[model samples]
Target chain A: DAGITQSPRHKVTETGTPVTLRCHQTENHRYMYWYRQDPGHGLRLIHYSYGVKDTDKGEVSDGYSVSRSKTEDFLLTLESATSSQTSVYFCAIRTSDRSTDTQYFGPGTRLTVL
Target chain B: SQQGEEDPQALSIQEGENATMNCSYKTSINNLQWYRQNSGRGLVHLILIRSNEREKHSGRLRVTLDTSKKSSSLLITASRAADTASYFCATEPTGPGNTGKLIFGQGTTLQVKP
Candidate 1:
């Protein structure tokens, strides 16, 4: 729905390895966000971008970085992944209008670090 | 650090019963949103309430936003087994082009037994 897709529906990796997850949207929205969901903590924003070449860190952006080089793609990279980072990663997109628009979510990527 | 937080971290109920969950946020927001995640795979946007509005309804879902108290409540009437999932509340921060960028709260896991 809304043409949002996240790569690697599921992944298993070892600690200290770098991993990059990709989010692609066919809807051509102007805003994109990356978030992680874990037990108890709910969904925490990792990063978000308002437009291409513009990005900002979220509350839990310590070990994460993001890039949006184009309108349709936003990439989230985990530098030196840790076990604590194991969680479901989600991508969201929405139009630029501030007129009560709902954010669309992708099917999420489940990452497990051993 | 999350801007919103859900209470009753977990809730269990029977089919045909009503389910209620609460969410509280720290900062002022333009609007609030509710999402449902089935099996923690993906989050489906359910409903949204703006700061200026007090209550909104969609099908069997009802959402109430108390901007004064900085809290909100979601009620699902006559919930079915399919309603078993984790529910999250998200806030759209007030700013330029802040429509789709949502800050989420920890979720409440709801288990509806059939």
Candidate 2:
């Protein structure tokens, strides 16, 4: 479990609506990541934060934004949801402060846009 | 768009048989890591092999990295039904000021028959 939890385990929303997914970790990990898993595409990074208020875009960051106001929480927001944005979202945390990076993931949020 | 590509998009084997998955990357890397995702759940980190290391083992899992060939492989010995899941390989490139960003592969769907 790694003490990571994601909110809204499942959600169904209409296109053009705004959606926000929350990730909370009790481990006080330095790095947090948001990723989406889609069929055939596997998992693609959307956004990540190295520390509080230090977020960066990932490969698929066009329609998504993220925020981290505290070390324990990271939020991923879709300004305007689209059909293509429907996917299972995962939040990961890097447990290592050393050179080697190993990420532990949360349970995930399954979002569907219609 | 993806740095790593896994071979045999899908695999099926008996519980006692060994399952092997191969991953090939496009460029030089700092490390190669493997992850497993059960259906409808988040990914779980399995093993990681740095570019400097050839092989590493954890329990029944063995990971080998070939930086010269820009490839890696994951071997699960005496596979069990619980081993059935999707496996993905991710790469982190080497350089100064590295963000430790990981580019993931398409992944391989592994099925172990009981």
TM-score of chain B of each: 0.95, 0.97
In order, the candidates keep a fraction of the true contacts of 0.78, 0.71
Prediction 2 TM-score vs. true: 0.96
**For model 2, what is the C-alpha lDDT against the true structure?**
0.92
Tens-digit lDDT track of model 1 for A47-103: 999889999987789999999988999999998999999999999887535445778
Quality of model 1 by C-alpha lDDT: 0.88
What are the clashing pairs of model 2? none
Residue A29 in model 2: lDDT: 87
> What is candidate 2's lDDT per residue for B20-88, written digit by digit as tens?
999999998989999998988888888888888999999999999988899999999999999999999
- DockQ for model 2? 0.77
**Chain A fold similarity by TM-score, each prediction:** 0.95, 0.96
What are the lDDT figures for the candidates, one per model?
0.88, 0.92
